[model samples]
Target chain A: MLKQYSFEKTAVQTFPDNVSLAMRTENLQVFYGANHAMHDADLGFPKNQITALIGASGSGKSTYLRSLNRMNDNIATVTGKIWYHGVDINEPNVNIYEIRRHIGMVFQRPNPFAKSIRENIVYALKANGIKGKAELEERVETSLKGAALWDEVKDSLDKSALALSGGQQQRLCIARSIAMEPDVLLLDEPCSALDPISTVKVEETLLELQKKYSIIIVTHNMQQAARVSSQCAFFHLGHVMEYTPTATMFSNPQIPVTQDYISGSFG
Target chain B: MEQTNFQLKKQDAQSHEWDARLHRATRATRKDWIGRGISYLCIGVIILVVASMLWFITSKGIATFTQNHVSLWKFLSGTNWAPDQGNIGALPMIVGSFAVTFAAAIVATPFAVGTAIFMTEISPNKGRKVLQPVIELLVGIPSVVYGFIGLAVVVPFMRHLVGGSGFGIISATFVLFVMVLPTITTMTVDSLRAVPRHYKEASLALGATRWQTVSRVILRSATPGILTAVIFGMARAFGEALAVQMVIGNAAIMPKNLISPASTLTSQLTTGIGDTIDGTLPNNALWSLALILLLMSLFFNALVRFIAKRGQLKNGR
Candidate 1:
């Protein structure tokens, strides 16, 4: 119904050898029972940086993000090589649970476990066999501080996480993932359900987190991509259309679809 | 003033039309009233029947203690229940009823939880296609058929295994366990399905295995609902009469062992009601048993409501 863009002329870039990559995909494609939801999405996330995947509704950015930790295991058929920490983690025999421990995910909705704030952070830690009281308490504090939530929630660690405000819940989710001390954090529109103030707070937390964890965030908000990301990848109709520096993609988009989308003329 | 009067005249005409429309008995409105009136009449009839039954049972049950001069504590605490020979103690039947119901619930709960987990979390599509109708058919089965099967198969099996009359507490418990299994399983499946999808997703994304996720988060969130299901199954088991009567030997004595013949409130009431005179103590004692059954059902319902309210409070909503 709208003007269609050619997928053949995508402006994806290849970083030089000196730029260290935390994770990379080689021709990653996704299929939901023959629907081919994502196609040939080969992208790289740099170490200790935030890369935002921006796109419209039905774009494959979220699909691609979910494939990194194999979260789409039963939901869709993803085919390609997902290289993480010098291993092809996409293989079926690879322990996805272990993969996820090193590379964590945060969902669009703020889905904190129906637990207390301390328990929400310590649940996965305990499951991973961290059973000491002092270590658990320390990880809870440090992860909460890492997500910038410690100052507000320090006094009430026993309170139910659901009792927190929406912003605080989202931040707690970030802390829960960071508590695992993941090398890469994949967020699928983590702030889309949040209010403006919450969104700004999440953005600030993300910027602060980039120094430790490699973050790949899929968002529908263009300004969020510009503000929080150093690298930007624009997706359209299951294709990766443009990948560039965040400033360059905002100022001079390499393709018509990316330009029209960010300028709000996308029909 | 003239302009306002002209506007007022127009408004008066509009109001007259509005009044006519308001009073008009449109066909749709008449149809609505007829439907509502029929439903209300049905509910009224049910309410009247239930209220009258309650009144009749209460009066007749109270007659045993008041008109026949039996003390409340003796009726509740005494064990000998020879109603004809004036030894009417209802404690044996009370204990029998509770024993069978609790035994059945405890045996069936683990099986129900396992099946419900399979239906909801493990293989949902296959469970829906295969197990759904199977459970529905189980619910639709007549209690008499279940009783018959218990009499033929389970009774003989118990006789061979334990070397007794085959009709005892264990046989009735086996029958009731089968009967209440489907009820608990279906309700448990519903509650498990009601758990939010995001809880499972969040747990899995945090690198927890499926077992850990289901046990820690999904099952934790659904605990109240699953408890309600178990309680509902227990209520059904407690109230089921004819099936339990057929398998449980109607001997009104204190049960000493699992294999011994015992009498529940329902079994004793059914066995003795037809043979007793209207004003006699035996008939009145049967009525008293019915009252206890009614009160126990009400207690179970209250317990379910309490659990649900507590669950909501814990969820912080």
Candidate 2:
């Protein structure tokens, strides 16, 4: 067996003073039973910018992203402090549901509820106690528009969301998340399942969304990170190996591992 | 000359091998045909048995109107059920069957659904491992045992609490409720488990509480499946003979109240068929009741199929 690298002692990079953070985590660790899946993942997501967490498979990028909103609570035991709005969300007493409302997520797959397009957008809004018909309709249109899907699906608002094409379904999922007006949106490989055209469309949507919400994304595609993200974190063996501006990270990676990974020598 | 002879001998061996391979292929084809024939024969036999049983019931049931000359409408709609006097109204038994089954469903639904939700969604993995098998064991228990329990426990309990004769609609309903609980719970758990984890995650990610996720997203998505379970449970309660017969007073009268004595079609058939002479009007009337039970179950089966198809359509399958 190979020697296990201890990532717990690795130093996390600090952001510049000019950057404003929307959310940050401190000493986050995840364990599935006895297996420590992630170790000491301290990362910061800047406000109104897209931050991409890129790594090879099993590098714990997705796990760290999921912990931001406590989505990992269902299956894994997460430890350490997720700092948001002067509160440690990882505390046992914290209301996970309330936190998740502000930190919405879009999954790797397009999992639109077996509902209509309109209902898909308004479901979270309604769950948050938005009952006005006019307001619900308005949010549906606005959210769909924001995801760049309204022009295609606005005419068929009542049709089942499942009937849409794969790319459209993914956009609908995006719209569904933004409908909640979450301050931060975490996307786990949102375009990894889509075709090239859909991928580009989603990348464009993420770029536009960065103006409104802080976005943290985990992507296996390095080019996607280069395209959409302002800040990029390269994870290796459950540690942030390098955190830098996306342009510099792509053009002149400071670490040899990040350089090797970006050059596709090994993943 | 020796080399040519050897080549000829090798060619002969290759041809022999080819012949053997062809023979084996033919034999395999023959085996496949035999297997297919057996499958078709088994299916045909099942169809034949069911068709014959249906034909027998239909012919015998119609004989009540033809040979005995009992008015068909009166036999169905009339309130009185006297074979010797030949009044023979089946309305009370039909009503009793429906009432008992409805009451059982009402009693069992919440409990079964709650248990199912606990098993699938709420319970931890270890708890699920234990609870699932126990509920399955409940299903394996025989109907007679359930009847005995109803007689020994529920009947007496009702006597003390509800001031009844301890054997009536109330007792029958309680017994059927327990009887159908396992089936409904198992099916509901399966349906709930069939819901994709992604749907729950999506709802939860939207900040919905666990209960809200289950009720709005999981249950709504699983509606068609849950409805199918309810229909299946109702069918079981409707067709159940021994348990309901033992707990229900088996009186030929209409159910006056929840505590009043009543009789279902199955109860009447089981209790009256043995005493009445075969080939009599009363026997044919009992056959008619069996026909009605068969029809009701068939209706329920059709309803299940209809709902399943609707679900498929909604899913765009």
Candidate 3:
């Protein structure tokens, strides 16, 4: 057994990069067909900082990320209140779309719309009601640059997005979310499928992106969280074992499970 | 080493001799030949049947069409449909087919797409499992039963609604739309289901609601397959006779309104040929009209196939 970090012990501590809460999950639980997959979890994400949710398979890290935008509302029976900027978005009157528009998500796999590369970025903008071509073009360029994919794809924006490499597609997806100008970005294992080189590119993109948007990333890679994130939340068996600064979580993890997971002894 | 090489060549020669000996013993038997012969003969029979039907219709229809020096303009423009007076203007029947098919598609397409989206995206796991099989059962119901229901129930209701001239294109179309709904729904569901789940997730992750994801991403991605389903439903409606024949008024005059009594090209051919002489020009005209229906359906199918192929290629790249 490992010592658990309680909310009382950690809640009062302020992050080095002092920023307001972009999102905070309270007692989130999820079930699928009578099978409980995620138990009660509470965590707060600081604005303009990368918060990494690290866990083994089935630790409910992905579930926690999904609940940030109520993305699990479609296929699962989810119970929780996720607070965003002082408002509880789980209330019936709170519009999920408006909530999500402020909190964009990038999935594990790169799923570009079966459309042109240019249209991929423009789709989010248009769906949010941007109709002017000139403004859209400018946003597209700005987002591509932010994702670190502008130079490779700027000449072929009109081509189908499926033609791009895997790394490029993932970056394009990031660019798409950025184009929406969301205040927070949730990434679900965004680099699990990429090669090491591609993973490095993605981590670099995340490092640069944290300057503008608060990010909560779900990852199985311990070193990745160590490298890019400022805060780390280590989850084990649906319970959050520890929540601390990345350096402290890596070097002085309070839980044996988190230690075993980080040392590659057992998942 | 040279002596070993010679031994390897000698062994190869011995194996070659054994292979030839086995081949001679395994010669094909009479039964094998008979089976092959029957397979070829069956294929020939299928081809013959299809060709004979085509020839029978074309040989007779071409003569009638040419002998009448058929001004397609007069045939299309003339509204008179009464054959008792020796005037066979088919404009009424053509117009009737269009009205019925259009009305049916208009009502059925939206329902099909909506049900498909629900099945593929919205329903709970249990609800999806239960609803899918129940929806599939709709397609198994016979068209004749549909006709009987329309005749016994729908016509009278329309009679109350329109007050007179109840069994017309509108009533027939209502029944046809319901009948086609199952096919369209199933096929549309298949197409929507085929869209990768990631697309839906991607859209929703962007903060698009379920409806927005369905309308903008899932539906757009599944457009080609859905178009194929609609085209198929339209073809089925165009060729539908059992239900339409019972509900349609069978009046051989032009319909001035949708609720007015009318006849379609198929209804005329079926009832008209039964009362006419076997080899008369009117009988030949039936073949000509049937040929026209065939051409129209073929054109529609080809158009759909072209679009579907283009979509597949685009997706493939």
Error of 3 at B42 (Å): 5.4
lDDT of 2 by residue, A1-267 (tens): 323444443334688878779998988999989988887877888899999999889888999998899998868999988889878999989898899989999999999999999988888888889999999999999999999999998789999999998899999998998998999999999988999999999999999999999999999999899999999998887778788889989998877777778998763
Best by lDDT: 1
Give the residue spans of candidate 2 off by over 4 A. A1-12, B1-25
For model 2, state the Cα shift of residue B242 in Å.
0.8
- Per-residue CA lDDT of model 1 for B186-207, tens digit only, reads 9999999999999999999999
lDDT of candidate 2 at residue A123, scale 0 to 100: 85
The DockQ figures for the candidates are: 0.84, 0.76, 0.61
- DockQ rank order: 1, 2, 3
Q: For this target, which candidate reaches the highest DockQ against the unseen true structure?
A: 1
lDDT of 2 by residue, B157-257 (tens): 99999886888998999999999999999899989999999999999999999998999999998889998999999999999999999989999987889
Alpha-carbon TM-score of each model against the true structure? 0.97, 0.94, 0.85
Clashing pairs in 2: none
Please give the distance, in angstroms, between residue B54's alpha carbon in candidate 1 and its true position after superposition. Answer: 1.3
lDDT of each: 0.93, 0.90, 0.83
* Clashing residue pairs for model 3: none
Q: Which portions of model 3 miss their true places by more than 4 Å?
A: A1-21, A77-81, A90-93, A132-134, A248-255, B1-45, B66-86, B122-137, B313-317
